[model samples]
Target: MKIGKVLIANRGEIALRIHRACQEMGIRTVAVHSTADAAAMHVRLADESVCIGPPPARESYLNVAAILSAAAITGADAIHPGYGFLSENANFAEMVEAHGFVFIGPRPEHIRMMGDKIAAKDAMRRLGVPLVPGSLGALASLEEARQVAAEVMYPVLIKAAAGGGGRGMKVAQDESGLEEAWRVARTEAKAAFGDDAVYLEKYLDRPRHIELQVLADTHGHVVHFGERDCSLQRRHQKLVEEAGSPVLDAAQRDALGAQVTRALKQLGYRNAGTLEFLWQDGQFAFIEMNTRLQVEHPVTEMVCGIDLVKEQLRVAAGERLGYGQSEIRFQGHAIECRITAENPDTFLPSPGRVTTYHAPGGLGVRVDSALYSGYAVPPHYDSLIAKLVVHGGTRAEAIARLRRSLAEMVVDGIETTLPLHLAIMEDPEFQAGDYTIHWLEQFVARRNPAR
Candidate 1:
């Protein structure tokens, strides 16, 4: 099960990240790209490259057949679907194994189970994981939703059973709003996920989005890598992420990590996974689990001193997790800002040729990006262009380092969220770590007023 050659069935910064890890492991990489990414960084750095399809994701990155064919032709021993695209697609995982290539992720059943929010919650409950109080399954009718909402109290959230990214989610303040919320949620869910099934959960007034990173191997060993505070979000999309949350102590981290590892062990999970939770009033409630590597994994790696991608490769190659939970240490504080090609104020996509590109450098600073001076920022992919990460001995020092790094970063010829991140770093409330998931929206509103 040695992964000598890997086909990276992804693009952009994550694809480059995986390529670096493979190179470090002495593994050859085959970059699969669309025609639009012919000059991308990962493609240029890879041992070999293959054109998958056109710019649109459906005809290219998401095309399972094209990716499998590329792997077969390249003689790749495995396929690494980095983070997005087919990363969490259970069928794609199965297809990879069926084609005699390793899938560097969890079992297909784990991916399929976690993809369904209701099924995931149920499994978590069975495995003794804490969950937000709500319906045990999808509501069959509006009447059923009403009963569940009444039982859980008002201001309940109507969420699509198979949704993410706040797509099929709505809030009902009271009974008067329940019917509309239900209808809209179902409609959105059907359009987005092709599944009209919706569920209800009691919405917390103010909750911090915290997630635990866990790694498991073919062996029964499972360990958690503390937590990340991803509360600085807009419309449920995280912009800033911090590892070893400012509010959590070592005791709390250990307790939650123990619980997560135990639960994942019971489920027989494997590879790298993240368990997302809502933290409010000192209690953690499981929301969902991502069966692949997360975008903000660098922060965890910085604090834990572990290479998650390398560990993923090792575990996928049937290697044991030689270390255990006790050996894993949470060191200093780390923060990551997701820099996207968009308007700083309006959040509109800004895609064009980059005239200049310069990433910051110094102690404990890492820039994960595929952007270059003359490259064209394609509009076909995610808006995220780079991740600016910084680490320090303390949270205050981390903030100071992040500020300096932000000032040093230069991405010209296109609007990016760099200005927005700089403002966030300067905000007193953010510096004090006194914000929740709603804080970003309010901060943006206060800054704009017109919008």
Candidate 2:
């Protein structure tokens, strides 16, 4: 049951990433793109290409029907949903499999269970995985939310039942805050995910966002590739990610990975996914689980020397994993910086033609991007322009390399957050790995001196 060909059901760097992995495996690739992405790097890199629909995500990347049709026409045996778009859609996965194409991800049921925040937290609790104390189920009403907050104690978090990317989340410190927060959170959730249900959890003050990467197969085998510290973020959007988190000890790392594996086993998960948590006060609590591959997966690949995309394809082809936990080794350190097309100061999108683009390269430097010097960055999609990844024998060396790479990197014509990234590397707290989720807010406040 070897997968000879794969239909990449997304665009941008992730699509190109999967194409490269497929090429190494000798598996032909078919890229499905929108009208705007006809000349995208992913399209040019794939062995074959098909136009799905218009530029909007809903009509193109998220259109399950068109993707299935493309796969059928291209004679692809499997589909890779990269990271975003239809990656987490359980229905899309089911449709792909139903159309006689393997979906390179976990079982649809597993995706459904983990995609919903409330169900995911409950699953973690049932597996004896430590979770942030909160309501065990979705809130029935605002009164129920308040009661749960009262039971969990004040300064709790209100989150969308089916949410991510920091959308539909609010912090309430008092009864007054709970009602207003709930109303606003529900609205945001509906607008973002079309889900109005909200849940409650105790807020971990000054928490570090840490996540474990786990790869499992249809067989009853699961193993972790260590953890990534993604605490440096803006509005819950990960800006930088690094493997071998400086905050965790060997024992803590083992415990965290074990907890994630046990929880996924209980839920009967397969394929590659991540367990996200908030680490605070020397303890970790399950926040949510991503049923799809993450954007920051390259850092894990660099440190572990395992091509996650290849493993994903192999697992989807009904093959047992080639290695065991003992064979898995994490050596050295790796860091990834996301280069977004945005105003450094205002943080607003700045999409336009790329007048100049030069990705830094040398020892311990890798750039994953879809942009070239003359590529016109469309205004319809995300602002992410590139991902700069660096690896070194130690965290300090990795930081130094990243600093040097960032200094050498050049992108002209449009504004970028590179300047802000440069500033962060110079910050003492960030350099020391002492920054938390609140660090960015505080940094902006200090820099602007006014809101």
**Best by the lDDT measure:** 1
Q: Residue-pair clashes per candidate, as listed?
A: 0, 0
Q: What is the lDDT of candidate 2?
A: 0.90
lDDT of 1 by residue, 1-451 (tens): 7889999999999999999999999999999999999999999999999999999999999999999999999899999999889999999999999989999999999999999999999999998889999999999999999999999999999999999999999999999999999999999999999999999999998999999999999989999989999999999999999998988899998899888899899999999999999999999999999999999999999998899999999999999998988899888999999999999999999999999999999999999999999999999999999999999999999999999999999999999999999999999999999999999999999999998
In model 2, what is the error at residue 366, expressed in angstroms?
Answer: 0.9
* The candidate that achieves the highest TM-score relative to the unseen native structure: 1
Stretches of model 2 off by over 4 angstroms after superposition: none
What is candidate 2's lDDT per residue for 1-451, written digit by digit as tens?
A: 8899999988888888899999999999999989998889999889999999999988988888898999989999999998878888899988888888999999998899889998888878888888898989878899998889989899999999999888999999988899999999999999998989988999888899999999998887898999999988888898999897989977898887877777677777899999988999998888888988899999999999999999999999888888888788889999999999999778889988889999999998999998889887888888999999999999889999999999999999899989888887778887888888888878877777755
Reference-based TM-score, model 2:
0.98
